[model samples]
Target: MEIQEKKNIYVGVQTTQTRDIRDFFMEIDSYKNILVFAEVGEDKVCDNSLELLGEANRLKNIRNNDSFVIAALVGHNVKKYAPTLFGYGADKVVAFDSPMLEVYRSDLYGEALAGIVRTYHPEIVLVGATALGSELAPTVAAKLRTGLAAHCTALKILDNGQFTQVVPAFGGKVLGDIYIPNHRPQIASIKAGITKKLDYAPKDGVVEDFSCELNGFERMKVTKVEKETETCKSLNEADCIVVGGFGIGSKEEWSKLEELASLLGGANGCTRPVLDAGWVSNEKAMIGTSGVAVRPKAYLGIGVSGAAHHTCGIKDSGLIISINKDENAPIFACSDYKVVADYKKIVPALIEELKARKG
Candidate 1:
């Protein structure tokens, strides 16, 4: 197929949020190209980053190769992986190597990215929803003063030469479609796992290393980097999840919920109130909207009210069994099966039944 070159449409890329915010605006596009921000030395480029490239490649094909994909990296050893990123579909890799970029500080990375975007006006900009990504994407959007969408689950190009950003709203109960109709560049941040990565193919592309001048605002001082200690497997990746809500009644009764989860080879999760009440760690809590979205093999909702926020996260689970005293609870509507009884009485009995079944 003959690849058509798009005279418009450019994508701006930036490192994870730890970099300078202004770096997002440094580019001026003479033609249509997708810019991918390469996070060097981070070892793991976020899954969403590769997903964006894949989508861009797909768009390129749909546009008959009228567009090209360009990757931008800022680090000391960026040249090493230029070939790898190109193989993944980038037509060009722009490198900005420096010691300052080694450690990501939002101020520095943001500045560098912003400068690039301003110099090259891309039609669209994509970033991962990581800690650094969340921080930097919004800042760049704000700086560029353009429309920005967060936590998008899907992205596509409309036939009319516009980008469509789809995300879950009201706690995943509904999908919201967003677009920047009048903006020069529509910006969106995509959640990981929502999209798939494309296979790497052989491609010949140019790798250009350019020296950058870091100014005062571009240099953000770091006082400390405190690492979090209480690490647990993310709920989104769990095989099974047992969630409790206000109906669990008391902190003392949590053990019953934990026991049931253990039997099923699952981990314990909770609603917002339970986590706020200190019954479980925040990481173990499974509330709606604010927590991780999960699609486990089995989800046991104990005493949950089935509010829009709480139920939205678990709707994707393969099996859902809800335990509530009130048959009319909103949660019942979404459950595969429902048990109308007091959790205090039924939980212990259910645990025993599970154990007996195992035996």
Candidate 2:
């Protein structure tokens, strides 16, 4: 591999795959580390991305003992997070630092990630299926011309060293498994809370600074960067979550859900219709494919009709209890405990019991 000096590259970047499918084959020993794309900010790394370091470590323990856990950090002033990446099970951190790469564009980020894979030759790649990741994962996979399993609920390793990516299919009625048999680097974008993150135990890991061509689509440039107030911080880490559905009834009734979450020391979420109905305004509060994916320890679903889109997000909860008026609602199929009752009656009784216990 050759390293280029920092030059102002004006030409558009290009992607080149190493070999054709028929010709692409490597000895098992040749494939090395498990690469994670560590999405970063100026001050902190994305929680979802940091969590993948732990996932990589677990996968390495079970599937490939010889592989190192390598994390690729790309952004301006992001070298500070490399130690945190190391503390969270990363054995190596590849830093692609540059001022021109401050604002994230899908094309440039995609190119840098793809370049890192080519240089390091990692056996597997994992990314957090975030707003940026959802857009970025497919781009990197396209550049490398490999298969990508999107929004995986779970992952398993086969006896023959191949890994399976588990995702929802058939309108959330069945789970589909995906794998890349012919590709050198198998890639999957995992949900935020699917796996646990390691404790912040600082370790002295290897760090390397590298650069990719910072040239692309010249017409586009980020002139302004606005940061929204982080209101949904607990949604990712909250152990208890109370979710409402379209069947949750009138806007006035929705306030009870918030009250329940507050009493339980949890967070509240709603389905997409709740947003469209003007019952809720925050788009980040919606949980599903278009919103946040959470795997809380306990999930309470009231008046949920069990749509495929919404069920996909909560299917992995530690304990799932749902109350719906209809006994045959699709949500019943996914819940561990179900009650065929109305939320109005059940919620108030539960709230009263909790309040009584407090008093």
Q: Please report the candidate that would top TM-score against the real structure.
A: 2
lDDT (10s digit) by residue, model 2, range 1-359: 01112221111112236455443344435767799999875478988887899999989998756788999998888888888999999999999988867888887888888889888988888999888898888888888767787887667787887677876665555556676666657788876766779988999987899897867633367889898776754676788999999887778988999889988989998888898898977777888755677888999988888776677677678899999999988888889899999788899999999899888
In terms of lDDT, the best-performing candidate is: 2
Model 1, span 138-187: residue lDDT tens:
88787776667876656777787566776555544555667665444567
Alpha-carbon TM-score of each model against the true structure: 0.73, 0.82
Q: After superposition, how far is residue 336 of candidate 1 from its true place, in Å?
A: 4.2
Q: Evaluate all candidate structures by whole-model CA lDDT and list the values in order.
A: 0.70, 0.80
127 Cα displacement, candidate 2 (Å): 0.8
lDDT of 1 at 89: 70
Clashing pairs in 2: none
